[model samples]
Target: MRVSMDLELKDIPGQLVLALKPVSEFKGNLISVVHHHEKKTPRGKIPVHLVFEIKPDHLDNIISLLEESGISVVSVDEKRYLEHGAVILIGHIVHTDIKDTIDKVDNTGYAEIVDLNLSMPRVNRPSSASLKIDAVSKQHMSAAIELLKSIAKEKDLLVIEPIGIN
Candidate 1:
């Protein structure tokens, strides 16, 4: 079986090698790797295109191991429906339990918080953050966003949904 994966790796020494090491553990033969060092992906990480050939039965295990290792596999095969989205959460983000809100999205399993940027004016003052979420499908992405929105409403925060590019 042939598999193509797009991954984001840190731009540090040995990061590429570390990303490729999982292939060998899964009995996969490395075919090609296109590493871009000059340009970073939207998520501000090095983008790597990797191709490998492995036994069909080992595919799932290999994917699981990659995800478990904190490697973001942006795409696999030809499926292009994977959703990427961002939202802005306004109000007392830090005081209202930021970690708990992040945990809610992370615990869903269908989505992940890929990036966060927070700004606070003063202690007990209003704060806001931009959260980037990645999910398997549009529905799951929307569900995750809605979950955050609900939590924000309950905590007296404001959720600005689908902060898309024009």
Candidate 2:
């Protein structure tokens, strides 16, 4: 998995090395490190941004080691989305409660709708919607799409799923 971390270091020298030593000790593959030496946070600490790939189990240890070394971790973002897919629905999307549909997918936790484009030619005509979903893995993406299909059936909508999505 890939992780992005924002850290704050003291203004003293060798802080960057101290901050990154933990990641290396934990066997994380360093992707990039942006040390903002010229900039300082309101707390008078330098900000550093780091991107790395590491085993899921080792992430916590890396953070712990960094904190133990006096590196302040401002934020940690784990990039979990590894699969993406898009589907189209043709029906009375707005009248059928679009928000409810979106909520159902997002509540799944493993998947969520990231982008949506709606096309309503006329008020009385059937509406069309293009939805882009992101999920942690291919299985989760498939399950999310299946859930969408079931919702479309309940709303009397026509689903146009992409070929080879599975």
Q: Count the backbone clashes (under 3 Å) in each candidate.
A: 0, 0
Per-residue lDDT over 1-166 for candidate 2, one digit per residue giving the tens place of the 0 to 100 score: 6799999999998999999898998888899999998899989999999999776789999999988988999999998777888999999999999999999999998899999999999988999999999987788888999999999999999989888877
Q: Which pairs of residues collide in candidate 2? A: none
Instruction: Kindly list the per-residue Cα lDDT of model 1 for residues 1-166, writing each as its tens digit.
Output: 5678998887678888878888899888898999988889777799999988766677777778778877888888732326789899889998889999999998987788889999997887899899999875677788998898899988999999865423
Q: RMSD per prediction, one decimal?
A: 12.8, 5.3
Best candidate (score: lDDT): 2
Cα RMSD, model 1: 12.8
Q: In candidate 1, how many clashes are counted?
A: 0
lDDT per prediction? 0.83, 0.91
Error of 2 at 130 (Å): 0.6
Compute the lDDT for candidate 2.
0.91
